[model samples]
Target: MPRPIVLGVVGDSGAGKTTLTRGLIRVLGDEHVARLNADDYHRYDRRMRREMGITPLHPECNHLDILTQHLLHLRRGEPVLKPVYDHRDGTLRAPAYLRPARFLCVEGLLSFHTETLRSAHDVRVFLAPPEDLRRGWKVTRDCTRRQYTTDEVLRELDRREADAIAYIAPQRAYADLIVTFTASRTDDPSHLDADVLLRDSLEHPDLTPLLEVDHGGVALVRRGRDLLLRIPGDLTAAQVTGLEESVWDRMSFASHLRARRLGEFTVGTSLRRSNSLAIVQLIVLYHLVTARATVALGGDPVRSEWSAGVAPEPT
Candidate 1:
């Protein structure tokens, strides 16, 4: 078996990392993908963090060296006894034994903080929703799911802001792709626009032909050495189908994997779909399966013009 393809999805808390990862896992099949949340590596529990005046966003709050070792092991097709962090009550739980599958999806706050940690993955994606939007998301998720009161979540956000700037924001410079989802004109959560910055670090599917079509509001623009692809949320059914088919046509080799809908998300127990989200997920899916194919052929999965010497501008 080819070694498992590792994918790192790094973002600040409530930046839609889980939503994006969940969609990919659904398409990739849960059984074939080993999931790891980097939050499990927290060095201190919630109460300890409060007492120490430290936040999880800071590197010192995480067992990063151990996390790096486990990531390296997974890349080499090894099993790990991964730690579990219970978010509901903000406590550390017993470690869980995890075996590597065909792909490893690691999502968390600081997965890409160090070079060794970054190099363990075939794909690195960063979520960078607008500050206001992310705050709203955090409030909603923490209040409803994590048992955090609105006031507590807001206070925590304020406390973490400094560390977010110093530590979390800088990781965007290292990602192959930066994804931002913003509210549309009507402020509908389900119909948010997606702006994807495709960095030169990875070879992405060519979307130039789709740009020529007058399909709703989809666009691909070149920005310096990178490409920015925008997908509007309110696309017509026909337009959405055309764009999806164009990408699906290119990755026909992996056609058998498209058994479920791509952009299904929930807003307070109400399930919704977004054309923009679907398109973003499809593009990511393209890279993942493409990388898997390259690895199976005994070739390096990444083909890049990116250099460590060139520091990317913060997105």
Candidate 2:
């Protein structure tokens, strides 16, 4: 049997973790991917957190040990009764059964809080969007989906900022890839540009060929200790298709990656596609496919710690 490949995605509230995870699911197919949200391990519900003056972002509010044990179970291809946290009313639902699949995507604010859990992942990603954009995303999401007013969302953001800095932001240092999405034009969140920091520690497939062939919108540069790929939102659909095709060409054995329309997010009742997002998804998918290949060839893909970072910055 092929071992499962786990990808740990950590980020603060309103970061693009869910968006990225959703795209990977679309590409890999739901049946072949198992999804787990670390937020479900919260020890207290919404009212309890408020009464105790504790935000859900803190470690005390969560069951970190149980979460680590569950991660280990999943890594060993076992089923776990994962807790479910209902975001609609900030309550806990009944536990749900989760079976391991070819790929496991564990995403939440504290997915990498412990060494044991971090060691189980084949890839660790951190989403670090600009504060203003993240705030906008939070406000919009809370208002539309969670029944919160704009003011209430802003207040909650202020309350969580401290926990975010102390507990959440520190996880970036352990991520193999740091993904940041910023506005392409001033005051325009619709067209966002992506800056992906590929750390030196991991053995990543070279994307230089795509950058060279499509130099108009995609550019690669070195930043401190990581390689940064800037993906502009202005790229036309044809340009995006070409880059996606180039990536697919290199991984022809990854038949599941033939799907192009993946990870579409809703914006005020409409779905949208991002050129930058597409590239990021393709690169991540490449890693997962190659890791699986390594296992098929009787090699250990999880031999090294692809989690630690070395002063990665956006160029």
Candidate 3:
């Protein structure tokens, strides 16, 4: 059985993390998955906020310790006393019971705020939409849902940018997957934008299907003295179609973004050092690195390796 897995989707406000999480929930199904929006972890009550003078976005403002504790409990297969934040009233409504399921998805700002919080995630995905798209989404969301004028929203966004960098940005270095949706170039991005998702694909080190060179087959070629590829072999139409289909499957499996159009970008540990972008990238790297670490430690390589080493040792 798979250990309890927790996936975190972190990004700037209106970066489409919620939409992505919802889509995954539909795909993965509710019976096997649980959702926890990190917004529920905010510290200030509306009255407390009026006194303390801060919103949920501020690091000095939220209950990081309690949120960390709950996540730890959830990972341990225990029910968590989750908080409730009323967006309508801007206050903590009441504590709620959040039971662990097969998969737990925690989505929101500051999900990767601290090492403790970071340790709880098995898969950390960062969603960094382009600045223009993020701003537009925030503007629209604030106006429609948060009851803010355009100017006020923009001002708040500008103010939040600094705090976001300091508190939220550093988390990206640990991300296992970093998703950035680029605006479509063919369309007029200024007026209409299409999302071209990018992923940093980890080459599985096995390219057998990708390089199908055999006797009387396509010739072989080398790239940069590294990227090796086999030339096409003499294949009949049916054989050619089969090879093409197999290659497509290989590409899809290795490709990120669930769509192959984006291709593989790059990933490095250096991503954890920067600010907002770093946090986004680091979160993805963190999961990937953590998964690799588990495999290295002779544990099952999955998102939730933290749940390993809990069972009794056989005498």
Candidate 4:
């Protein structure tokens, strides 16, 4: 087996990092991968922040050395005890169990904040959304997770912008891929185009291998063109071949392959099939670990963290 690849995805808060990670986890399946979130490294709880009048967004407000230790353990293919962040309460809850897996993802605002953490990753991704878009996301995410009202979220965002520039903005230059959704123009874009770009980068192989497997006791909803021959468990060599065969038949353009593009075709996940109750207890591992359809507005692909401040301020 090939040595597992570690991908580090970083960005400012609410930059679609969670959404991208969740989508990939579903596509690749949990058994083959693991994710770590950097948010869990927050140095204080909401009460502590309030008492100290410190915002959680600042890099100085985190226990980064502990984060460094956990990541080093994962890279060595050993088990690790990771700190857990409570999204609802905005604090560290407890420790989490992290097992070794084939592919590991470390994601967060400051995953690449230091050179030591940067050296552990095989691939690096940075996502930065436009000020408005991030504000929009922050509003929605905070409301959902912490029951904060829109106005309150915006207030918090205003105060945090300086910290983002001083701390968060600089990390982008070190990333292999940088994805931003800041809309420069009035019209915004659906995120599908961005997903398409990211999917292209991963460049998954043609559906040949996935088409051969036999799906076990799949529900009626699981049948048809957009289905994958999901091997429910470990397979023997011959069983694996049979699995591949089934997947290929689905991927083949035998009038049944799902459409990938307008004219192009694909197999499986062509249509989103979300179960109301999600499959796993998704705890974003910190420490875990994009692209552009060029939204009509902010479509520039430049890695501008260094010059973001010095560049002429647009009116």
Candidate 5:
């Protein structure tokens, strides 16, 4: 069997990393993908972090060396004794035995912090949601699920801002795709606009023709060697179908993997769908399946032009 294709999703807390990966996982089938949360490799628990006055966003706070080793192992189709971090109480639980599957999705704060770690992934995605939106998300999630008060989450965000700027934000330069979800004109949570920066590190499906449709919902712009794709929140179902069909037509080899829904997410307890989210998810799916095909043919899954440079600021 070809070794598993590794995807690295790096972002700050509450940047929609999990929400973005969840749809891909559903389409890929839970059993076919091995999941790794980099937070599990943290060097300290919550109490220890507070005592030391360090945030998890700081490189010194994570066991990144161990994470790189485990990522290498997984890429070679090997199993690992992965550490577990329980976010509910901010404690490290017993380690879990993880076996590599067809694909490995590693999501975390600093997955791309080092050269070796960045090299382990066939596809690298960075989530760069606007600060206000991310803070709102962090507050809601931490308060409701992680036992953190709103005030506590807000204070923690302020404390981590410096580290986020120094460590987390710089990793965007190493990503093949930079995804930013911003609030729509109406500021509706369910219908947020998506802006995707597609770097030349990977060969993305041609979306130039979609720009000619004049639906006023999707636009693609070129910036030097990269492309910026903008997807609006309120697209009609027919428009979405047409857009999805264009992408699906390019990846007929992976048609069997399209049974599950894309862009299905919950706001609090209510499930909602976003057309822009579906488009973003499908574009990502295209790359994953394309990489799988390339790997099966014994070819490298990523382009060789990838180099470290300043990543464009998110729009």
Candidate 6:
């Protein structure tokens, strides 16, 4: 069996981590992918945490040691009894049996919080959308799906802000890619622009050729230690189609993909396709596929060693 390529997607509460993870799973066949949520490792249930004055974002509130152990086991192609966290009511659920698949996609708040956990992934991604945008997303999601009132969501955000600043946001420095989505002039969330930080460590795909498209909305610029990939928000459907083609230009199996364009944005009862989401998923999917290829050629591509460091400020 080829070594499973583990991709870690880390971000704060409403940073679109699950949506991105699901999109990747859809693109890769689900049977070939195993999914995990880091939120499952919380040590205290919602009620307990509240009574103890601790937030889930804090390491003290989570079972990081167990999470680290599980990550190591998963990377070694071993099964684990992974814990479960029910977001709907913030309760701890029964553990689930997880068998390693061809690919592993783990998404949650603290996947990169420890060296042991970080060492288990072949790719690390951090989503850092603007604060306002993230706040809007959080409020909407909690109210609609998690059964919280808008005021309650706002209060929770206030409570988590300190922990987010101290713990969750710092993980961005360790990531190979940092993704941010911002509103366009019209302030439409669905049509938001994407600012992606492609760090120097990974072998990123070159999208330079596609920049010539009229109003391509894709630009690459060098700033200090990273390269930024900017996708404009106002691109037409045809323009987005062109960009999607460029993303898959190098893939020999593009035609056979289970879900080529499968990222969606949901607000209240409305669900619509999002070009920005699809592009982000595609870019990460490209890295996973390449890592798999490296393993096939027997080069030991998966990263099994990790070190701790302070994350640098966004450039």
What is candidate 6's TM-score against the reference? 0.93
For model 3 the local lDDT of residue 158 reads: 81
Listed in order, each prediction's TM-score against the native is 0.97, 0.93, 0.63, 0.61, 0.97, 0.93
Q: Which ten residues in a row have the lowest lDDT in candidate 4?
A: 275-284
* RMSD to true structure for each model, in Å: 1.2, 2.3, 11.9, 14.4, 1.7, 2.3
- Model 4 residue 223 lDDT? 22
**After superposition, candidate 2 runs with Cα above 4 Å error:** 186-190, 302-315
Cα distance off (Å), candidate 5, residue 23 = 0.7
Q: Is candidate 1 or candidate 2 better by lDDT?
A: 1
Winner by TM-score: 1
**For residues 184-244, what per-residue lDDT tens digits would candidate 3 score against the true structure?**
4333222222221222222222334434543224232333222222322123445444433
Q: Model 1, 1-315: lDDT tens per residue?
A: 899998899999999988888998999999999999999999999999999999999999999999999999989999999888999999999999999999899998999898788888788899999999999999999999999999999999999999999999998988988999999887888789889999988888888899788989788899988999988878888999999999999999999987888898999989988788888889888988999998999997754645343556655
What is the lDDT of every predicted structure here? Answer: 0.90, 0.83, 0.56, 0.54, 0.90, 0.83
Count: clashes, candidate 2: 0
Residues forming the 10-long window of minimal summed lDDT in candidate 3: 266-275
True-vs-predicted CA distance for residue 89, candidate 1, Å: 0.3
**How many residue pairs collide in each prediction?**
0, 0, 27, 31, 0, 0
